[model samples]
Target: MTPSDASPWNSPGTVRQLGKMLFDHNPTLKINPSVIPSIVGWGLRFLANSTYERHKANMISNIRIARLSLEALRSIRQTAHLNYDQTTRGTMRVFPRGGRMTEFVQMCREMKQWGVQFEVLDQNQILEKEPCLGAVIDRYVGAVFFPDDESGDAHKFTNEIARLATELGVQLLLNTNILKIVNGSSSRISHLSTSRGDVSADVYVLSLGSYSPILARPLGISLPIIPVKGYSVTVALNGWKGGPTRPVMDDGYHAMMVPMGDRLRMGGRAEFAGYDTRVDEEEGWRVLDDIMKILPVLRSHIDANAVLNWSGLRAMTPGGPPLVGPTSYANLLLNTGHGPLGWTMACGSAKLISDLITHRQV
Candidate 1:
């Protein structure tokens, strides 16, 4: 069924988590919030096969993120970008529509408008750029190549930032959970009631990811956010010559494969399965099958038996783009609702939020 015909529980865009995020709103929360992702989606590997694929998947916001990520990475002193070490120089998006190969003409136009460079590649060009794609070149009509895009390990970057923050005298409360917020009618939060105890700060910025809405609703604040669960699978390339040289989004299969250092991360598929983060083996196989269809050469190049599965909830905002600004509360700021663009826009979002908090122009 198309997204319009699907139930809120199954529809990828429906906002069903508030009933559960805010306990007072509805104690009998029926959203169920089970977030089971398919077992082995190689991350963005299923972009081609996703039933929920949209023609206007918010390409404008994508350009903003792409530009901002570069700036932010440099500000943080990450050598990954400076050393030209980004595993994937760009992304190859391939898809088919109505028994014919589809070209991303409009998408290219939008990207160009936003100063993001891209190239349209036919079967021969695609196979030349990525030799491993020779196995499934005939399955797709054509592909779009985004030359400036990139892929890297976000976890490592986060840890490095955390280290820098700590060294710069930034206090980080580890293993701390906020039970509730203590705020008066005014725009400032006095302190936060937490599992670790009461912690007070002059200003508060909530970046609770998907749970931000739940925390803000009680304070009479509303955020347009929904938790979209996405899945990933990491496999060992082990010097496999057929492995993807860059990120490849096979839109026809609804999945993508990203080269992460020595590993290959393939994944794609957004499930509106609420807060559940379980893994669905059957669905995982479906994702895997789609990946195989896009790059059959991977079967001989990599070991499929050793696969690592992962699932995470993305705080998706309807129509793409994220909410990054202040709330009605003067002292209580907001920096959440990033959705799938979290990594793509992380540093840029952080830079914007930081500039806002510091009363500086962006």
Candidate 2:
């Protein structure tokens, strides 16, 4: 089977479901809520002037939560294989537009005010940091380096966390289909009617990612969640010395490559293709072509046969923030529409939900 056919997780729907599952069980097994109501999307709107200050605060909060997650993984020896490899290595966000960089510099300043270490770099400085960027340096004007940002295998991280959750008495039912969410009296979640049987919970939190809006429609909750399909290809390093040692985003091409162990994961582009998971071979190659633009030297080193292509649905909200909070139902809560930053904000969202459920101050 080809990589697309061989891997079940390659489908857009599967990845979204897995992401939700990861967050759901990660904190749920500990009796802590795995979903939370949060206004965490404000931080990602770096280009918007109106919310720049709020965005900075959100960025700081996200960084802190990411650090907390790294610390949690560090405490456990089994997580080592998950590549929770903590590094202070910064990420370079390269954009083609030079004039717009001024706004980014101002945003960096705001981030610094919130204690996020960031540096604005010119084209030469961008190439100096990562020579892999030399391929497309001329296509971009400058870049921003978030010194404290991090990257890890979201798949592995989720698996490790889920394993720990299972070991701690969380019952993991894999491949089970949830048909519908049933609401009973007084706008309270009654029970989730699944393919297997009806499972009831005192409190129900929606962590279904792209599927949240679909499931909520029956209950009269209209969520502004759109499934944006994203593609990724994992290219084996195979002793390719020119490979980047850190994550680099080609803002011009809208593609990013993250170094994970011996493999380079290149992910980019958002296609509003509904729930379709089929990846056109030509389109997949196109994504690789974009990767080549950013790392031309590594093109020859990349073993075409060894590349693992994948497509996932990102439940992108209109703005960048997720809709996290109590829905119309008293017992039903929402934790979906996280888009690309779900992994970065997972633990924090989980903790918030747990705190809210227990009546603690959020």
Candidate 3:
């Protein structure tokens, strides 16, 4: 069934309905709902600790803020296929999930207009309150933490939209690598040289994934985007012991595990290996070590010999946020440099870019 038929994700109410359906039925989407809190906690705690001695309190408070925002969302607002754990991250607790494959982003202006808080629930509290999770009262659950949000299938989402782009008479070439760009005296991009023959469009979008820099240099602009390599090991789980009921992550080790349909996807690490897709089983093992930390009871279930390792280069910009505005070029627009959050912000970024170029609104 089509996405619209599957769920009316456009509205917040439908998001809850869709999420509940997925969380209950689609095991793939029912993953790592607990990371937002952990990442929010540690990231802020660092800032809080350095700025003052009470950063820990500030971090927790910030999580509470995120919690309020998350709580505002009806249960099942969005489902994820990812999660994070901080068992190896010292006393810090904010853990986030799956690729956080954000199903979509509702703009802050829209949220305000809709009378919804711009912020979601506290990230930490998300972990303690996950429907898929359980913990003793007053005893914090060390689970994936984050504001209640959702993620979708990125490959399908990208391919589907890219197909729509093609339907609208937009020419897209896959497996054709872009090599260099021709710029003019004004430093505007005149043409793009690729493995395929050259034909120019009135405007160009640099949604080139990790290869964003290959386009930015021609315009005399330097995007601080870098290729941060992350690896994934997809493995089938036999039962609760071999499989995880909830998503988990260990931010300290930069590793995370996701419970996908029939497979348990484990990944996390920024090995800047420049255009390499090689999967290191040893590195995967290192990541797995962090998983064992949180669920030590499942150590017996560790099939050290079983893993389907794969890698993807995430385009990371210097600033944690992405680059999604027009460039110095008169017509060229940018929608890349998203890094891991690409899935989180894909639709929002696309709509934003489309508005700017298609309608001249930022």
Candidate 4:
């Protein structure tokens, strides 16, 4: 995990971008009419809670948490011996504009103080590291390489972990839709009304990503989380020798491209639309177009029509840090609102929650 926040929702340029997204007809960031009221309410609360001092404190805490997450994932990878198409080739953050490179240099100095390891690379060094980017080298001013950062398949990791958990006596319930959380006479959650049946638990942990707020609202728990939609397009590399060997984050377009086995997955854009999970083909094309600009060589090797488009909602909090640990209900705990860093922070978040539940040192 990187020490700096690169999310479009929480970056330094968020305020200016938010203004455009709210007012202008920005293609990348859309605000549906129905979500405006909710957005306004959340915006007011966000402003009230997000003071400069508070944000600084949260950033420091989150940096520590992110470090721990990276360590935890490494430990799991080594100890479990589970292969999820993991790679340690690191990630490169390329800056197209000189101004963005300056901002990143400032961030690098700040992160260095926190013990985050990174190397600043010039155009020559960046091209040397990944020669596939040579075609678009002129488009970049500079780059930052986080050698400790990693890339992997989240779906593979989850399946492997689930299999291991089942061997450890944890029951698996598939295709069970949680209708609602039902509470008994006491203050805690009694059982969950589900598609299969009502299931009771001694302690309940809410980890339903973007949909957590929807379920928590019935319990008077106003989680300050909004579902921010994002898109991804995966294209088969077709044995393309010019494809990037590692992950690359394009600072200019707020997009990222990662090599996943035989496929190259690129994701970007943040939409403020409410709960709509529909995959827009136009949006997919736009994301593909943006990523192609960063790696123009992909045009000849891969067929544009063979790409897979996906869309998902990320649970974002007003403040960057996720809502973890206990809630008002003693038996209920929260482990959501991770935004774009959900996969990066998942193992550490799970560890923290487990320690909390076990009453161990966290």
lDDT on C-alpha atoms for all candidate structures? 0.65, 0.65, 0.48, 0.80
> For this target, which candidate reaches the highest lDDT against the unseen true structure?
4
Kindly list the per-residue Cα lDDT of model 1 for residues 133-170, writing each as its tens digit. 77667776777787767676666667767877787899
Query: Candidate 4 on 244-343: residue-level lDDT in tens?
Result: 8888988877788888888888888888888899999899988888888888878888888898999999898877678888887778899999887888
Identify the leading candidate in terms of TM-score.
Answer: 4
Q: Please, what are the lDDT tens digits per residue for candidate 3 over residues 123-196? A: 45444333222222123223323222432234554565566567679776778877876665463567778898
Which scores better on lDDT, 2 or 3? 2
**Predicted structure 2, TM vs. truth:** 0.76
Report how far off residue 288 is in candidate 4 (Å).
Answer: 0.7
Better of 3 and 4 by TM-score: 4
Tell me how many clashing residue pairs each candidate has.
34, 4, 37, 0
Stretch of 10 with least lDDT, candidate 4: 3-12
What is the lDDT for 92 in model 2? 72
Question: In model 1, what is the error at residue 189, expressed in angstroms?
Answer: 0.9
Q: Considering lDDT, where higher is better, how would the candidates rank from best to worst?
A: 4, 2, 1, 3
Candidate 2 lDDT over 163-213, as tens digits, reads: 878888999878878899998865788898998998998888899998898
